[model samples]
Target: MRIDWDVPITMDDGVVLRADIFRPVEPGEYATIMSMGPYAKGLSFQEGYPGNWNRMIEAYPEIAEGTTNKYQNWELVDPEKWVPDGYVCVRIDSRGAGRSHGHLDPFSPRETKDFYECIEWAATQEWSNGRIGLLGISYYAINQWQVAGLRPPHLAAICVWEGSADYYREMSRHGGILCEFLGSWFQRQVVRVQHGTGERGPRSPVTGELAAGPETLSEEELAANRINPGQDILDRPLDGDYYRDRSPDFSKITVPLLSSGNWGGQGLHPRGNLEGYLAVPSEQKWLEMHGDTHFSPFYTDHGIALQKRFFGHFLRDEDTGWTQQPPVELQVRHPGEKFVQRSENEWPLRRTRWTKYYLDPDGQALGTTPSSGADLSYETTGDGLTFLTPPLTDELEITGPVAAHLTLSSDTTDADVFLALRVFDPDGEEVTFIGSNDPSVPVGLGWLRASHRKLDTQRSLPHRPWHSHDEIWPLEPGVPVELDVEIWPTCIVVPAGYRIGLTVRGRDYENEGVMLPGAMYPMKGTGPFLHGNAQDRPAAIFGGVNTLHFTGGVAPYLLLPVIPG
Candidate 1:
């Protein structure tokens, strides 16, 4: 393999972004695989993300097979494995990250335009094919959706693995409630590797040079160079240019797409992947939903194999059996962390039995028929309520999106609703699975702010309620308002004698004794995607008694997509 270190690619604005290109030594021309992100390109995966890397290496020993693993970077394709497979791999340090120098603004239109220029630059290279394919996890994948909307001429395909494309709804805010994930993420992950950290940051194990940059910058200078992502998000409480500028116009994404989501990824990934598949007008697209940690699966044999086949068919025009690929692929989850692979023609499966379980406040149970019951109320800071069904008479499978219809009233002007779907064994022990970040997570999670309950009727579906976060309709205290909450998609197959549960909480859900032991932050049930921002949820306003009223002739109920055998 031939390696080009710190190759300079000038952008349209004369900003020269740096990239490391790995390609076959005797290559004439090959499909180019590229990723540009805030994470330094020179930083080794093991050094940049020690905990995740160590855990992945321990869980899947096969990940260390056949390669040195020294070149691995976070959420990026391993060059050692791909360069030898007749593909050109380019990893760019996006403007103001790593060695590149510019004003750092992630997810900004400027960064996306830079990416467009990089794709064009890679296409004109001596050992590069005119076709460019984008492949990466998280941040890398997020940008692909943005740049693809620009319709770069050389861009041919994209594989968005575990990424959130909708900045406001799926990322910064959930149902108009500000999420702490983006702010925490920008601080812990992005700023740590931002350019100018220099000598203070870790050095690249491969090159023995500063991973951030060559010059150490003062704190004041560093602050002036980049925008505060967290504060920026908090400032824009209502969705407008702030988020619309960062998010992709899905309809403009016409490139071949392979969107892979993690079913257990409660907060971030699931919505975007499913939305991309359903919204993108791409003539050729596939959606694959799986179960596992965020970083591990991207490096495993299964992930690489699927990527190769997809890129092989689209980029190289080689028959890698992708011609027989189905429109939707699901790793159907079962009890005991088991996943069974299955394929279908479309998402939410056309044959799904859309079942509704009425919420009986009096019994604190879910039943087939709507029951006239008393209203249920709880402290805004407490575990609101848990409604469950009796043991199933036979095995039941719920394999798609879920929704909840409820009539709510709060003492304050607003209320934050946190929903958790869970499954329990015959003995009543709660069954949990390994999530993208958290070790144990519920079957499905959803959130809503009563003030943002106004729906985008045109975009809303029975199973998925799309909220127009553009405006807020403050709650009239003590007055009932109907809310249709859209839970992220999930897959679970419960056996007979097992009960299905739903816990509606006033705050982030937490497992009694579960915590991601080496994670940068405490990842309870909902990972780091907590929504307890003081400014957004001031105690004086959000801290109050919340009620679930079963009235207006429409009893509250849970809408589930049950797939028939």
Candidate 2:
């Protein structure tokens, strides 16, 4: 293997971005897998994301079975692993990051253009055969959608591993509430290593060189050289031109794609992968969903083999049997924490029996029969209400998007509703799964701001209703308003004795149950996907009494996509 460090790739505007290319020593032309992102290309996985690295190696020992993992970058393929497999792996420091020259900006129209240029530039390189595939997780995967929208000729395929496609819905705002992640993440992770931060940032352990840049810049200059992404997100609370420009136009992404998502990543990961697979005009596309730490499964033997097969058929034109692969692969989850791998022709399998479990105020239990016209109210600032199903009489499989219909009133002008689809074991203990960032998370989650209840009827369906965040109508203080809250998809197989549970909360969902030990980082309620930003939901406004009214005419129910056995 030969690695060309700091290889220069000049963009259309003549600004050169630095890349590290790893290709076979005797390489002729080979299909290339590329990743470009803000997380410095030279930063080691162990240093940039220690918790993920440690969890990854522990769960998938085979990831480091042979190679030294010396070239491992966050959410990217190990060059040593892929280069030896007869493919070239390229990592580039995107403009404004690492050694690249430009103002530090992320997910902007400019960044997408830069990515397209990089793909074309690599196609013409000595170690390339004109075919290029984008690969990586989150940041790396997010840009793949953006660049593919440009329809670059050489962009042959893409493996989007747990990435968000909608910059507004999936990332910045969940339902219509503001998520604090994008803001907090920028301040902590990207600011210091931004382009001009230079020598002020950490040095590379491998090359013993400055990770940001070769030349240092003054504090004032460094601050001015980068965009304040978080603040910009805060300023634009509504989903409009700002997010649309950063998001992908799926109609134009026709390249073959392998989109993978995690069931636990409610705030961002799941929505994008599913939407990308279904919306993109790509004729050759596959969707796979798994349950585990975000980065863990990507490096597992299972992940590598799947990736190789997809790229093999598309990039190398090899008969790797990827052509016959099912359109959707799911890891059917079980309460005791087990996975049953199943393949099907499409997402929301045609055989899915959409079941509605009606809310009965008495005992706060779930049943099919309409409830006695009972009214239930919980303080908007409290734990809210919980409804449970009797232990299943038989094994039940709920395996698609979950939605809720509630008729409610708020004492104030608006209310926030949180829905948690959870499972409980035979021992009566809550069942939790590994999330993108949250280790202890319930099976499924949904959130909706009462005022943002306006639905797009043309795009609306019983299974999933698209909410047009274009308008907001506050609740007539104390008047009943019906809402359709669409919970992100989840897959779970409940045993005969276990039970399914629903918790309606005024705030983010949190498992008051025992937490995992030795957690590297603090993951609060709803994990990092929280949306309790004060600017969006001020206590003065939303902190009021909330009510759930149940009756035959206005029954509140949980609609689950149940796949029959």
Candidate 3:
């Protein structure tokens, strides 16, 4: 392979974004795969992310044996794996980060437009073949949706590997509660590689050069160069034109798509992949949902094979038989990280039997029969309560979106309800799964801020209650109101003698196990996805006594999409 280092991509407005291109040694035009992200292009995966790198290598050995990995960037494809296969790989440092020069504005219109121009510039290159496909996870994957909406002519295909499409719903806020990820992410990851990091930041171990920039700058200059993402997120509590402009319009994306979501990614990954596949105007689209570490799967033998098949068909016009593949592929999860592969023509499988399990206040059980005139209250800041079903007599498979209906009153004007769908072994041990970010987390998780309980009826389904977070309706203190909480999609198969447990808490879900310091996101009570901002959920508003009303005429229940075994 031949590497063209520090190539300048001049945007229409005269800013030059730096890119590195890797092409086959043989002189011939080839379809291109590119990633445009704020993460420095020169930050070698092994050196920059040793924790994830070590874990990924141990789990998927073939990944390291497959290539030299010299060209590998975080969450991006290795050039060694693709360049030899008649594909050119390109990595561009988004303006104001890495070697690029400009005021850093992450995920803004300027960044999206610059990405569009970069795509077009790549198409015009001599080694381009005029066909480019976007490939990566998270930041790299998210921008593909945005640029694809701009509809660059040479953009042929896209592989959205665990990317969130909606900025507000998936990233900044969850059910109207502001999460700490945006702030933590900008500080830990973005700021280090930002344009003015200069001598203040770490260098590229491999290149023995500054990864953030070529020139050193003062502390004041560094601070002035970038936007404070966390504060920016806090200031904009409501989703408005700022977020709308940052988020991509799926309606305008018509390219062939392979949308891969992680079932355990309740935080940011699952919703967008499923929603994008269902909403994109693309005639040929595929959805694949898996469970495991967010980054490992993309480099595993299985992931690369699937990606090659899709690009083979769309970009090269090769009959790789990807078209004959099922429209949806799901890794139906089970205990001990086991999964049963299932293929279908549509999502939420047509055979799904939507069932509601009523909350019985008596024995803290989930059943079909409703109890009467019962009110169960829990401390808002405490480890709320757990409702379980009798150990299953037969295997139960749940494979789609989950929701809950609750009739409740709080002493305060607003409250936060955190729900966790858990699994318990016959031996009485709580079972957890590997999430996109967390090492151990419940099977499924759902959250809602009582004030933002208004539903988007047109987009709501029995199993998936869509919330319109545009406005907040403060409750009359101590007044009962029905609220529909939207839980992200999950897939799990329960064994006979095992039990399904639902835990509702005032705060984020917490697991009892090892927390990796090297995780992409820090493992907080809920794996860095906690929503306890002082501004969004003040102690006075969300810390008051909350009550769950059930039985009587009002039946509070949890909805599950049970699939036939």
- Best by TM-score, which number? 1
Worst 10 residues of 2 by lDDT: 513-522
- The TM-score, computed over Cα atoms with residue i paired to residue i, of candidate 1 is 0.98
- The TM-score ranking, best first, is 1, 3, 2
Over 167-240, each residue of candidate 3 has an lDDT whose tens digit, in order, gives 88888888878888889988788888987677776777657678887887887887897888788778887778
lDDT of 2 by residue, 1-565 (tens): 8988999988888888999899999959999999898888777888877766776788778888889888888889988889988899889998888888888889999989999999999999988999999999999999999999999999999999999999988888777888888877777677767776666787788888788888888888877888876678778867799989999999999999999999888777988999889999888899999988788889888889999999999999999998789899988887655888999998889999998998889999988776766699998788889888998899999998889999989888988888899888778888887777787788888888888899989987887878888887888887899999999988888888888888898888876633544444456436666666887788977887898987535688999998988
After TM-score superposition, the amount by which residue 85's alpha carbon in candidate 3 deviates from its true location, in angstroms, is 0.9
Q: Give the lDDT ranking, best first.
A: 1, 3, 2
Score each candidate by Cα lDDT: 0.90, 0.86, 0.87
Q: List the residue pairs that clash in candidate 1.
A: none
Question: 1-565, model 1: which lDDT tens digit per residue?
Answer: 7888889999888888889888999959889999999999888888778888888999998898989997999999998899888999999999999999998899999999999999998999888879999999989989999999999999999999999888999999998888999888888888887899999888888788888988899988998999988898889888888899999999999999999999988899988999889999999999999998998888999999999999999999999999999999999999887889999999879999999999887778988899767788989898789999999999999998999998899998889998999999999999998999788889999999989998999999999999998788898889999999989999999999999998887888888646444678776777888999999899988888998898776888999999998
Report lDDT (Cα) of residue 530, candidate 3. Answer: 78
Q: Per-residue lDDT for 556 in model 2?
A: 87
